[model samples]
Target: MVQEGLERLMDRIVLAYSGGLDTSVAIPWLAEKYGAEIVTVTMDLGQGKELDDARERALALGAVRAHVLDLRNEFARDFVLPALQAGAVYEQRYPLATALGRPLIARHLVEIARLENASVVAHGCGTEKGNDAIRIDLAVRALNPDLEVLEPLGVWDVTKQEKVAFAKKRGIPVPAGADSPYTTDVNLWGRSIEYGVLDDPWLEPPDDVYVLTRAPKDAPDLPAYVEIEFERGVPVAINGVTLSLVELISSLETIAGVHGVGRIDLLENRLGDTKSREIYEAPAGVLLHAAHNELQKYVTPRDLARLASEVGVRYADLVYNGDWYSHTREAMDALVAKVQERVTGAIRLKLFKGDHRVVGRTSPFGLYDQDRIAQSADTRPSLELRP
Candidate 1:
């Protein structure tokens, strides 16, 4: 039955394989169901060792070809930088970590589809009516309007448990425990956890659930002070130590995570029309956003900063709703680029017990004139200024 379906449309298929449960199962399922030549492409957006075994796992799962592209620098410069410059935080908190990564993944999927000349591009994104499906569909359609976009899970009229049972019956190796207490997404920016016990807002997140951030009570006794230097809105140095983008983020993550500086718990509206309680640990993101905002206080005028903040929220929504490649997003990017022109500066931050606060900020192109403001006649008391 599945074999016949594969035989009919199995000439070639390009899959955005993550080597996760669904994707790992999809590779073999597509090959068996469509008998198509499967080509897998995994984008290395700093997922660490999970990506290390991606090619091997893809081949092991019966993919004819596999490629893992290192997109760290491109992801940082192209996606992360623009979002950071715009101060695009969703719901005044989220850094749009996974949301920012999806478009790049879709772009790579399109490229791989073209390279493989695959008749169809497929993803393991289930019919959850979430941002993943929207992102992939929008990106693929924009890049190659004629290509076929396939979503197996969307059409599969089965529950997750049923899918697991079918895979097991077919001798498909599934990840340990088909059901997990939570669903987690991790990247360079942060880690977000949803589902399971989190559905109840009243319930406190288990201590073990937090991986990247130290517990507030467990944090160091003394405050840790650090200085971050930015060039055109991107961090280039930490505590006088110059580093590359990746190095800079990594360094900050280590420093901030230890102090429990970035943990957020919120009830956010998912794209799927549900109110979800999500917990995120984004130490570096917290530190960077605070430091950057502080730096802007010196470099950008009050009105410009306010406008940028407004635009940032809009930009965050667009990205979250899978409109990364939209015209409005491009315009917003241009506006952010202009704002970042003078956003070079150093921000001094103090971290202690799950908090990262700005203590001082300075910029070469600062719009601030402290001496003039201090001497302003408006600041003088009426009695002191009496003629």
Candidate 2:
């Protein structure tokens, strides 16, 4: 139960509601416990039916109002494209999907709070004592420092199972089935699953946990070839077909998912002092990142690429740790903008089960000198390498 003083402190609260077990429970809890009016805001970053159900569920959970904002174009044009341009990847494998989505979601939550005249902004993120809470709170503070931030799960003195029981006791329908052996977060860039059975790093992930890519053994026998075109570092076309950013990414997901081209299982250092096992399925993102990196090899200088590589890791850390709206992230973005100026090209790739091999690449800005390096050229003895 909430303390009387805290309840008086928040008469109107704007919640980052997803209609999930945590946020759904939060809606009624804030109302009943604090006498607060709950206004739920759900951001649409191309998570599909999940967003739709969240809106419906928020209203059903006694929220005074529910707002679903379609931020797909913003997500693709702003977040995804910047990462693509920067060639940002966490540890050269994971596509910061949910990580990239956080700042935008928190931004909207703050905006809604301001518009609704809400004194507080609440989120479902539990007190994991990690970067996510820090990230959301930071954004909230930056946007509206006066708006008190409330995290029900952060303060709630109960285990996850206990929270589920509390929801059930209140007649809130949790997602069916006992929770999967892993906790999964999904968005446009990709899906990441971890925890539960995944804690045992030695054990292989069960088949049921995968949502995007097919298992390697189940992939097709023949290889598929794809050509990707880029302009100023953003993917514009695939296989010579031009598409909107969202369509292009979606098409790549379908194509690459079939070939089992993107699946990663690794142990990563979390914001806390522990290391956790994580599995990711990011077919399109993996393909694009590879192609983008290969293309950059031709256009970008080695020194700039090296610097960008370091910045890329820091950029990924910021996203993963929820500092998306911070000065460090903005500085990283500026660095990426400068480096991406020359990253214009097209790359051809051969895709097989769980593998993507770049066959060829072309760019108007290519640094490769065909005349000097051609296989048919005579071996000219030289005292020193020339630019």
Off by over 4 Å in 2: 1-9, 379-387
lDDT of 1 at 122: 86
Report model 2's TM-score to 2 decimal places.
Answer: 0.92
RMSD of each: 3.3, 3.9
Quantify how close model 2 is to the true structure by its C-alpha RMSD in Å: 3.9
How big is the positional error of residue 66 in model 2, measured in Å on the Cα after superposition?
A: 0.6
Candidate 1 residues lying further than 4 Å off, grouped into runs, are 1-8, 157-172, 176-179, 373-387
Each prediction's whole-model lDDT (CA): 0.82, 0.81
Give the per-residue lDDT of model 2 (tens digit) for 172-230: 89875435455667777888887777878999888887888998789999999999999
What's the lDDT for residue 380 in model 2? 60
lDDT, candidate 1, 1-387, per-residue tens: 121123365698888887767777788777777778889998788765467778888898889999999998888888887888888899998998888888888888888888888768888776653667777787778777877777767656576777788778867677763587677777788888877788799999998788888999999999999999999888999999999988888788889999988899988877867776889988888888888877876788889989999998999898888888889999998898888889898999999998877888888898877888988967886776557
For every model shown, what is its TM-score relative to the native structure?
Answer: 0.91, 0.92
